[model samples]
Target: MPKIALHNRDGSSNGTVDLDDAVFDVAVNVPAMHQVVTAQLAAARSGTSKTKSRGEVRGGGKKPWRQKGTGRARQGSIRSPQWSGGGIAHGPSGEQNHVKRVNKKLKRVALRSALSDRARSGDVRVVDDLVFEAPRTKDALAFLDALEIGSRRVLVVMAARDQVTGRSFRNLRRVHLLTVDQLNTYDVLVSDVVIFQRAALDHIGKGSRPDLGQRGRRPSAGTRSDDADLGQRGRRPSAGSRSDDADLVLTGREQE
Candidate 1:
């Protein structure tokens, strides 16, 4: 099981808590995380972009000119697509659907993957509690600063309702206040650090995967290189079979 220490508001360790292995110990699936984040963003789109078609534009009702020569071409309606002030061609209908369907199982898996990635990188922090005497942004800001995350991007996950905390952190430009139920793969992956209230663990489903043990392992050196230097042509060539990258580029060109 993956475990993390619970910390006080002053950033002192209170105790340690074991995380649900299913939610925080799975192997990171980069592709799954990417796809889930993409889907979550897609679902947020309103897809309401609309345009007037040629037929919908104003003042295109009557033919501008008759056929056969007043030094003009034959006309149907002045609103035709070929004319100025015409409706759009193949434009949006204001009914486009941007929602993407990710199955419940896959969503859970992706969530686990993202959380695991963060946990593996030692970025998930647990706080024993975050109650406020009353709603105040300064307190929240001070709390985050004490945690060493005030200047960094943070995602705070709370279990119980705390409207005051929500209001306080919501205004912070670098902070995202989210309830346990509202937690998803996208936010988990995007934030530089994730702070979870101790009770928030209960909200994470108990579906631990024991097969994926330790992670954050790097790939073989033979396969590792900066992508910007080589593009997507895969791993670097071995020493014995080494050829100039320019030659490889030429080979690709020749194949094309």
Candidate 2:
């Protein structure tokens, strides 16, 4: 474990902070990092691809001509894959899967490796705490300035869920927030520096933390889940639900 001096709002020494050496001090493993990142990115892609073969084509139910044509070549249905306006012949459609599996432990190791590399380079910033009187953008900016981390891409690792803190930084470019356990290689590699509130280190590790309430009030109509459920259950059925009856009536009229 390594200790770093956290600074106060006025640029004074706030306190000392210790980091998890296993995550921040391990030797850099470039190969492992690359593999993990590539694998994760690959896993995120949707493999929804398919192709319509000749057999799946429409409007090709009957043969166009007999096997022995009169002076002309034998023919099949016009909608056959071999003919114009026909379905594709083994051409790729859009319904295949393209997911790759990777070991979870290996992914964790790669994340730790990336964190260690960043830590070794002095790119990790540990802050005493980000206490804001209110959820103001200026207050957040001031904190960033106090730590001399302004103007750089930042990933703020918080100890607990702070909706105000998250929302305040939403409009800012190159700033992100993640809880400790939620830390991943994508975020760690994308940012130039990682900032964590002092208490966040322990809170983000393994247990549940308090959710910082939202700054603004929410709409009253959809405020709670139970209310939404009740409203949905109270609604009447629609005309679409009688589609079967309508179809039966239409068929009866045709028969008559």
Q: 1-256 in candidate 1: lDDT tens per residue?
A: 7778889987898988887665677778888767766766665556788998987888877777777779777888877777777878889999998767765555656667878788889989999888777778789888988788747778787764566676666556577665555556766666789998877664453321112122111222234323211211232122111111111111111221
List, in order, the clash count of every candidate structure. 3, 13
Per-candidate TM-scores read 0.72, 0.62
Q: lDDT of candidate 2?
A: 0.57
RMSD of model 1 against the true structure? 17.0
Give the poorly placed runs of model 2, Cα more than 4 Å off.
Answer: 9-11, 48-92, 203-256
Candidate 1, number of clashes: 3
lDDT top scorer? 1
Identify the candidate with maximal TM-score: 1
How close is each model in CA RMSD to the real structure?
17.0, 17.3
lDDT of 2 by residue, 111-189 (tens): 6677777788888887776655566767777777877885888887766555666666555556666544445675577
